[model samples]
Structure formats: structure tokens, C-alpha cells
Target: MAGHDMLRSISRTFKLPEELFSGMPRIEINGDEEVTVENHKGILMYEDEQIQINGGNAVVQIRGRGLRLCTMTRTILTIRGYITGVEFLR
Candidate 1:
């Protein structure tokens, strides 16, 4: 499916509020340093590490040292790390 469609589907399945998913998460990678994720209802940050993922329903995975996730609306999630993959699944 399309990326937007996929996001919508995941949002619906997770029962996320409308306002929560209004903005897409901003994922930034800085060479081999650190990754930054912003604009999400929730935020997760990790330092000096790598991230990898397979898939999930409403969870974003990171394969670094560790991670910090914060949710502003208790719905949206922001994850920051050495992200390698982001998958939205059922």
C-alpha cells in the first residue's frame, strides 16, 4: 500500500486520536553519529548507537544502545536513534 495509506491504517488500528496523527514524525540521521526524530506526538531519543527493525502494529523499533519514547497525546510516538528501518504492520 501507499505510505500514507499504510500510516492511516496503522493509526486506525491503534485507535489513535485524530489530532495525534496530524503531523508526521520527522526522522533525521546524522552520518554515524546519532539519529533525531521529531514532530511526533511521542518522542524517543538514544545516543551513540544504531537501530534496526522488522515490523510492528503501533510500535517503532530501534536497534541502538537503548531508546527513549515520549508521547505527548498518549497516541503519537517519536523515536530517535540509529534507525535502520521503519515498518507499519497489522
Candidate 2:
């Protein structure tokens, strides 16, 4: 089997989510106040009104007011503020 296919098979056998092995970004939003992104590549832009994240397959765009970074790690980040919109651009 192909390398990727093999990895996928292994992941399934272990009951692991595919995103963990696929490098895809996972996003979670809470109400209109916060957003958490996992497996993100990096931050492309940051501001009080907007932020851009480098997702593996797409660019994550966040627009808001009073935006601030609440937490950040190598693969995960949390944004807090009055979130107005979220978009994924390919």
C-alpha cells in the first residue's frame, strides 16, 4: 500500500482521528467570543480587527472586534474577542 494509505490504516486500527495524521486544521468556536485552532501551521497576520492563520489545506481568516490572542502553542492557538466571522480560503 502507499505510504499515506498505510498510515491511514494504522490510524483507523488504533481508533485515532484522521485529522491527527492528516495535518488538517481543527477549529472550535465558542458562542461569538472565542475560537480555538488546532494543528495550525502558523499565524500569517494579526491585528485588533482581523487575524489570518496558515491552515495546512486552507487559510483561516478571522474577523472580529477587540481581538486578542489568549493562548498560543506550536500547533494550537486560541483567539478571544467579539468574533464576527470565520472563513476558510483555499
lDDT of each: 0.44, 0.91
Candidate 1 TM-score, true structure as reference: 0.34
Can you tell me which runs of candidate 1 are displaced by over 4 Å? 1-22, 43-58, 66-90
Task: Write candidate 1's Cα lDDT for 25-53 as tens digits.
Answer: 44555653344444433333334453322
* Ten-residue region with minimum lDDT total, candidate 2: 1-10
lDDT value, residue 31 of candidate 2: 99
Candidate 2 lDDT for residue 90: 79
Poorly placed runs, candidate 2 (over 4 Å): 1-16
Error of 2 at 75 (Å): 1.3
TM-score of each: 0.34, 0.80
- Count the clashes in each prediction: 8, 0
